[model samples]
Target: MRCAVANTTVMVRKYERMSGRQSWSEEEMAKAVAAVVSGKMGYKLAARTYHIPRSTLQRRASKVRYQQPDDPKPLMGHYRRVFTESQEKDLVGYIKSMEKFFMGVSRRDIRELAFQYAEDNNLNHPFDVNTRMAGEDWVRNFLKRNPELLHKSEKDYELEPVNFDQFYHFMCQSS
Candidate 1:
């Protein structure tokens, strides 16, 4: 009978299935290997021509040794710290000591002053001049420790009345 589904007029023949012998010739295998090794055709193209998977071709190709170019060296540079602990402490102390003279001075002013002090004293501190500003922690700690330094006047605040108990309480509560 003819098969109508595939539009074929050939007669259908049925029989027990049998395994076929390998038909791949040595010449064809050799040609495929040569084409892949040539480097002119990519392994993918070679695989397509040889009716083999690209990965299989790649594995075969990988067995061959190919020299790769050396990688470029990375750029070298130094990273200097902005401030040391000792420098930070000195800066904090300087600001606290000069608070009466520079009461209305902002953090920026304090930092500039610290920079000037460093420059004047020829202090070989590793702090970047841009980041030497005293923060609120420094001010709070300084005030807490030296409570007698907290003196309020109608004109300006002065470091006079050293209140130890009040300072201790303030520090404890804050902590």
Candidate 2:
């Protein structure tokens, strides 16, 4: 009997901390900036002590010293929202109003609505023009950020077909 083995090649990218994960915690970054700002420690020394990048430490320190941050501790990757606060609020309100009318909007409708709103208002958005809809990931995150909109059940989204089926059944039974 004979056995054979196959070899496969894997691709890897060069690291400039390319893993996309932050090595230091929010508290550590804050302290590093604070130490550098207060003249307690130099940027290089503070970064080394805090196990953070020197350039990041300097940039954060400059921002902290010069400007007011909207959020105290933002996401590590600096994930920014596509829509402004008011726009998101308007979307939530629209969804609520539609639900009150017994016409709950589906996920796809919300995405298309977002695309249309962004286009109509001439606002910059990252949604794909060809698809004419926001990505599913965006809708998922949007719902996640708005806790009140979440269903009482654990399901994050409602199936429109299933809902219609239930409604149809009720109507048929009444007739």
Candidate 3:
């Protein structure tokens, strides 16, 4: 019983130390995998040498000799999201196009768009019918999902290329 308690205490202390700490980086993990792959050391020894988790070493090693599929796991886009994957992409594009035109879209604009988009597409979601708008939670989730739209500097954004010749022709026609 005393030995069990001591082991538990040690585990608790280890957890406390490991919490919110980056003990090993990607380079170190790669080197550890390399050492194991080249028969220089076993997983247990490599993990100890690199200070990385043994399970992490195993996972990386398994992926090293195999090609991982390009299948991207969706981030909460399937369940509980206001828009489907393609729909969200369209909305993101709309938001980005507005940014390109130097027009700022507000939170209210997103909510209204959500309501309008659903109505137009006949999408059945539990949005507020009385206000003719989407729920605040939906809007918040939308922002979180599309983080690139949040706090992105205007200068960092690439505006659509302008055609000067067409503009000059239009201006000449008007004069």
Candidate 4:
């Protein structure tokens, strides 16, 4: 089978030669196992041919293969959040509502809100001891985590109802 070798494609029997900590694709691993199972190539030869780790290939070849795991592993290892996901979702809703009313939330307002959320929830957060507000880093990371919470100023076109009424009246009289 043809396999990629660096920038060029090379004609290989079953596996291509690989080095370092390069990750093998699922298809490549399956192909290597297929070669060994069909008695066309031995374990060591298939491993060498496919550029896969000998131990990894041996383990797969020895075991009765099953379907892949259905669940996805968590990206965050030990990192715990100050606020729960539900709380964050609520915060998002609140921010959206405020924006709907043409009220722009500032960074400080977000930090204060986060502090309040944690306090209201009785959560033991790693926030400041004296300031009682969420740290800058926390706010920055929160923005990163919740991309939909994009901070936008109230557009100039969106005037207050009173101002809009006055403008409408002025335009009607002039025209």
Candidate 5:
């Protein structure tokens, strides 16, 4: 099928039914663990009520009971959130608002702004200490993520004065 709005062809695939365990959301995990901890409900009962796996709820409840000092901190295993999700959304909003005033931010400008935001917030960013700027890759990924931000380059053209009448007169005289 062709999608007119997107101007692209969409493929329809047959729906396949697969049996697997469903993933639990943060809220669901917390609620299930809390219910089990409250002593009014058992792990199996709470899991059934929350529509989550009993084993998963049991694991979460155990973790909550025996939480270590470092467990409270956010896990920075793969990627560290230099800015929280809300902060990043705000940054994107600010950049987009600038476009409303005919002001376009370049990739470098965004990088600089990101660095300044991190520094001001004292966030532990992955940017270099010497350069004090976010990486080029980060800027590229940011642009990729926000496709609405168009990169428009303002061009400066040099205008040279030309006399068409003088050229016509010179051509007539020469002929």
Candidate 6:
């Protein structure tokens, strides 16, 4: 029989013609076992030479069973919220009121108020408290939601500056 190795064929017939009932000779078994025991050759290479699967060779080589490492833990943090239509309207109203009370409030304050009102009424709003940018954002959103407020300051006489006598007369008339 011929055995092929690296494109070279060597003639050897001692272990090539074994029948189905035939078992490995002591010499062949010893050489194969010694090669596996040496640990220098990888199990896949050894198993290929001996005509067995790498997994079976590995199982026969060691007694302990193999197990995969545990999966990593999920990230730690809060989830975002999904507001209903009514809840969204309420939030818009609250933000508008806040804008009317304090012009040019920071976005951080608006975001905090969103979260606070949500929490107070057992709702969920998922804005981060520590990182909101306020400056122009607060005014932009407030105006977008309450566009009438912009006209109030621009066209309404109530927002105009009045003399003390006129203011006194208006106050007295109202009282």
Top lDDT prediction, candidate number: 2
Winner of 1 and 5 under TM-score: 5
Instruction: Assess every candidate by TM-score.
Output: 0.25, 0.45, 0.41, 0.42, 0.45, 0.28
Q: Per-residue lDDT for 35-83 in model 5, tens only? A: 8987878987898888889988888888777864433245458754566
lDDT of each structure? 0.51, 0.72, 0.69, 0.67, 0.67, 0.48
- lDDT tens digits by residue: candidate 2, 1-175: 8687678887777646658457789999998998988999999899899999888888999987875443223446856566777778877776665555544657776677678667866876789999899899998898888877776442333533224334333433553
Ranking of predictions according to TM-score: 5, 2, 4, 3, 6, 1
Measured with C-alpha atoms, the lDDT of residue 117 in candidate 6 is 50
Q: Model 1's lDDT to the true fold? A: 0.51
TM-score of 6: 0.28
> Which is the winner by lDDT between candidate 5 and candidate 6?
5
Which should have the higher lDDT, number 1 or number 3? 3
- Candidate maximizing TM-score: 5
Query: What is candidate 2's TM-score against the reference?
Result: 0.45
lDDT per residue, candidate 1, 1-175, as tens digits?
A: 9776775697659765475433445566566667877766787787778776667567656654242232122235753323344655555555454554345334344435545555655754444656664344444553464454445432343233334334323433553
Model 1 RMSD to the real structure? 22.2
lDDT of 3 by residue, 33-88 (tens): 89987889999999998898999898888777452353223355565544677778
Q: Look at candidate 4 and tell me the lDDT of residue 173.
A: 55
Q: Give candidate 3 misplaced runs (Cα > 4 Å).
A: 1-79, 152-175
Model 2 bad stretches (over 4 Å): 1-78, 152-175
The clash numbers for all candidates, in the given order, read 3, 0, 0, 2, 0, 1
Which regions of candidate 4 are displaced past 4 Å? 1-78, 151-175
Q: Whole-model lDDT, candidate 6?
A: 0.48
lDDT at 5, model 6: 61
Report per-prediction Cα RMSD to one decimal.
Answer: 22.2, 14.2, 14.3, 16.6, 21.0, 22.6
Comparing 1 with 3 on TM-score, the higher-scoring candidate is 3
**lDDT for position 67 in model 4:** 22
lDDT of 4: 0.67
